[model samples]
Target: MSQANEKTDWLHALLLYGLGFLLFWEWLRPLSIISDTGQSEIFILFTAFLFLLSYFQLPFWLSFPVKGIAMVYALHEMFFPGSFFDFLWLNYFLSDFSQNVGFLFDGRFDSLSNVFRTFLFFILLWLISYLMQYWLIQTRRIFLFLLVTIVYISVIDTFTTYEADQAIIRIVIIGFILLGLLQILRIQEQEGVSFSKGRFPVYWLMPLVVVIAFSSLFGYIAPKAEPQWPDPVPFLKKTTGDDGEGKNGNGISKIGYGEDDSQLGGPFVMDDTSVFTAQIKDRGYWRVETKDVYTGKGWESSVRDRVMFEGSTETLFEDDVEVEAFDMKMNMTGNEEFDFIVHPGQVTSIETGKDVQLLENPLTGKVFTQNLGESVVLDNYNLEYESPTFSEKMLREASTEYPERLADTYLQLPETLPERVGALAEEITSEEDNPYDKARAIENYFVGNGFVYETTDVAVPGENDDYVDQFLFETQLGYCDNFSSSMTVLLRSLGIPARWVKGFTEGEFVAAAGDYREYEVTNNNAHSWVEAYFPEVGWVPFEPTRGFSNQADFVSDYSDDEASNTETSDPAQAEEEQAQQQEQLPQEEAASGSSSAPFEWSMWYTVVLIVIFLLLCYVVLKNYKKWLKRLIISKYKKRDDDKALSEAYFRLLWLLDLHGIKRGANQTLREYAVQVDQKLRTKDMKELTRRYEENYYRGKTNNDGWDEMKKLWENLIKKMQS
Candidate 1:
């Protein structure tokens, strides 16, 4: 018996590990780079780690800690760094808790080095925990195995909200649970510990049924919870560039510890932080960078940094000129209060609310804070910047005044240029007469030709002076930065002042406000475009980025019909009718009424209906069983007492009904009994009727009577069915 128990325990543990391996395999498979070439190496590493975790077996105490660490690690990757660990821990404890103090500490401590460290620590912790339990507690190994399996699963679920979409993980977890139950059942088999081993403890199935029923109910009724926003408390924000290192409020040095903080080489001064967020009616663009002066390396603001006029409340320059209105606002996410004015470059007037004040720059008339508070209110104001026309004409005419440093840097060409690039440029721009026309010709050429837009990781700096030559002639794959950088250098070689422009393109609109949207933006939306100075126009925007191109024909000629067809049809049709015959047919209705119903349910409607009906019948039977179980049966001393007689009378009547007997509506109990007895030719009919009278009047039904009645009724059913 001992040996059998030991074997069963080992088998259960192995099964549990096997189940874990399946779950781990699933987690790795969908996410692994091995599945798709586009996936990152880091993703592949993670999948491997998960596989190892599931394949290996450890004691309950050890597995629990390892699972906890794994869950935390997963959460860490999902959320902002160091943000979701506490929640992960909470989820872990909700699932399992069984670890030695030292083991727990050791497991967590060893998690410091790298990804593998956590796994190693978890293994050590599990081994130590198992050792402690084996030597000190001396508990049954079978029970230990059972406990470990339960704890490991509970921990996995608590930390990760398992979705049905991840079917493999779900199946694996379910397998572990079944294996654990099987182990417990095995122990009971040897020891005769079951509540009703002979009867099969059919009630044991009740819990699973109840759980599944509830799960099905939730699946059917639960609504999809949409994402929501937090509280709308107005916050003050100090404006900083994408790299975060920008000038402070006092403009002494860059502030806010921006993305370029390392480039700053030191901590930012607090005074450099300015309250830039302003309360407005809508969203508008804030022009933080103006690339005017171009050296070969980069662009900077022109030397004319003087303010034009004192703070003017009006945004319009002239009274009669019709102006385009672009109203906007900002929602700050930090705490700092101010009552200063805020306006875009085209503001014309002021409309201050409460204790707000507008302090314009003495030289340029640009707005700033007067009291230097955190939160501020800016009213109507009119402003303007140097137009693209003026910037271009100035660049063309002022050749002698050009910065000396910009000569070699911006105009430098590659030593070994591909002659094809120059030929391609010349061919594309052969029709255009001037430099501006030629530049436009080059941009149009790329947009119309076989050029593709995509991001690439390999952007090594050129060894020679001509980076543009390398990009245009050699590697054709690169991101927005590469494209614009190449374009700028090409234009400059033709004596046009061009520079790379780094800024986000237009943002996605927020329809709720009946205008554009905000807060939906993320870090990935940052972009790069090119700015070329024309003699007539200052610096015209030339967007060669992926999504911002103005060339319409180059984009795939996708019609609404095409979109509909793509969505509705199979891939085969998409190939056959590539450009036409696009239409979306409404999807066929599901049997259960929802679109998300599995295909099986739609295919087997009759079977599903039958199953549903059976389920309803079972529920009604279960409820009726509860009422029957509530009836108090008692033992009788007499062999044939009034209670037994009464039960026998009812049993006979019930038997008649099972044999296609139906009592007439007009017949009383005694009458029905007489008719039944007459059909059956029973001699004890009168006595049975008298017993029924006694049962109703004297109330003498007990356990013996109920048992006799049940036996007789069951026999009647069997006979009728047969």
Candidate 2:
């Protein structure tokens, strides 16, 4: 029996420590701090230290006093020192706290806010340890209940809210916690001091291991819960370039125009972090990167590493007889690690003033800088590209004779692509004869149709449905990715080679830096479009997404047969009409411009949580004695319901304690009640006391006297308040 009790005691202590650690896990995502940060480990180590002191059983007399001393020591070191009771007057702590509270209302996630929230998190974690210890000493199932909360927070932080690392270790911790809880349940269910040898064998843990193994396997294999609207509150944010020491990936790439690999219509939140500044001649599509292969889920570039350009100068689009030479000088100012921006037209040569290298992926036409170990300051570079000018005759003679090696890759479509997609493409382009006409027909279909463009509230395709099919037929509204990806799929269904392209649209031009016009390129300027591969012409950019112009001089005089009648008959006429269209953006749907919001209402959620926490603290402090009395009464009620009058007398003592009327335990019940009434300066509780004494001492049972006793209790309560 003693051994069994000893084992149970040890297990409960371990459970308390584990539960407190898990409570700290909730902050892992929100604080955006990892174990390696050394900041998060500070709190974790202190919490463990406090838990170690009370591992066997909390010394009720010393625990709170010890914690108070620790708090005083911490406060003195953090905010004040060499003074007693000066912390109450320390305006620095209060001012920062108040400012952070205001910032929460203003919807800002600043570092100061994180500091205040961390302080509150530590306090709440300490409370969890205290409560768990109390429950452990009583042999209650509360440890198991708290275990569920830990699991809930774990799932939210790791799977839903934040992409937490150390996944295997987290799973192992949870598995051990489950086994401990099960062992506790087993011990709790036993009847006698001894186990009767019916106790669970040590080998019973094999089943728990199996359960955890299968659970982890299923977690890996299962389709994630893609809610139509996921929980909108973000766990962490990439508001500034300096967040989390610049390590956290905010669902979007920090490397400007470098990569975007998320599924189409899958939601993400980005910040207004300034990625770069490009000096350009015009506000056209600034092509950064292109993707060749089209996966049913999204797009990728297997051909990216193939085309490498190390030389300083190279001519592009040499086969075309007629082209306009576009020469521009630019400087790289952002993301020193990555220096790549959209340069209009086919890049011919780059003349950098310093030692620099450019690697090109010919298949995708994506030029990336190899700035390995080189600090890329505002490195000045001059680039010249031949922007092809296509007339009706030039594009008409262009062939679909795609390179044999490239043909198979570009025309590739997932077998899962819906058959209706091909059929719909044929129907939309039925009036068109050539490939360019068909491509124009598809672009016109998107532009003329009543398809709305929205970034938020996007609905992802069903598990089995194709992304393009769902976008075209069911949800005919999306951002540049949706429009471009669907157009790419439709063009490919007809053997017209196309791929997804991503970069920035010509951003808001801010000022003239030296001789060039400088444009501020933010995350909002991140864009996606389509590149239709023409045999002699190579890959040409097309803005299938409405409200944006061509990135690679895509405006040709050759119009679709259906559009020729409605559109201008010449390039000069087309440019005039485009000017009118740009002016009409305000009157028409500016859906393209209103694509994304950098921040959301997530900070409001954090503020509300803090508000509720403060409210709870206020309640606890305001009625400390009443809460303590309720806790004691609950235990007594659980142990013996026949001692209702004794519970009532304990409540009276707590009430007297609240008024500072301390009565000795040797005082009679009548003496204590009288002292409590006199301290209150109101009606006495003499009859209530007499009835409670009769029921407690005489072992009297009266079912009818309960209502009169309740009346006396209410009167006493009112008298105390008065």
Best by TM-score: 2
List candidate 2 stretches off by more than 4 Å: 1-258, 269-271, 304-318, 335-341, 371-380, 512-516, 551-577, 580-722
- What is the RMSD, in Å, between candidate 2 and the native fold over all Cα? 21.9
In the predicted model 2, the residue pairs found to clash are: 307-360
lDDT per residue (tens digit) for residues 192-229 in model 1: 78343233333554575467556655765789666485
Over the stretch 1-722, how does candidate 2's per-residue lDDT look in tens digits? 44566565566457655654564454443332211121344455446545655563435675676555554344333223224456653565567679888877887754343335555666775786666555544454454554665565556555343454444445455645555655655565674333343443335456666677677777777788776864434334333433432112323222234465545554344434576676665446666666777667677777545345754222334366457666786655554335553576667677776665566666566666556634344355777766665554555567877778757877889888889999999999898778877887787677635464545334565567677877788767566888999888999999888878787777666665444566677766778888777766666566677555553433334346532443433343355346544543332223224433233222235435534554565456556755555565454433434455556656766666665678887988678767777766654477777887677567677443444576566556545531
Q: How accurate is candidate 2 locally (lDDT)?
A: 0.59
Model 2, C-alpha of 177: deviation from truth (Å): 56
Lowest summed lDDT window (length 10), candidate 2: 246-255
Query: How much lDDT does each candidate structure score?
Result: 0.40, 0.59
Name the TM-score of candidate 1. Answer: 0.34
Q: How much is the lDDT of residue 74 in candidate 2? A: 42
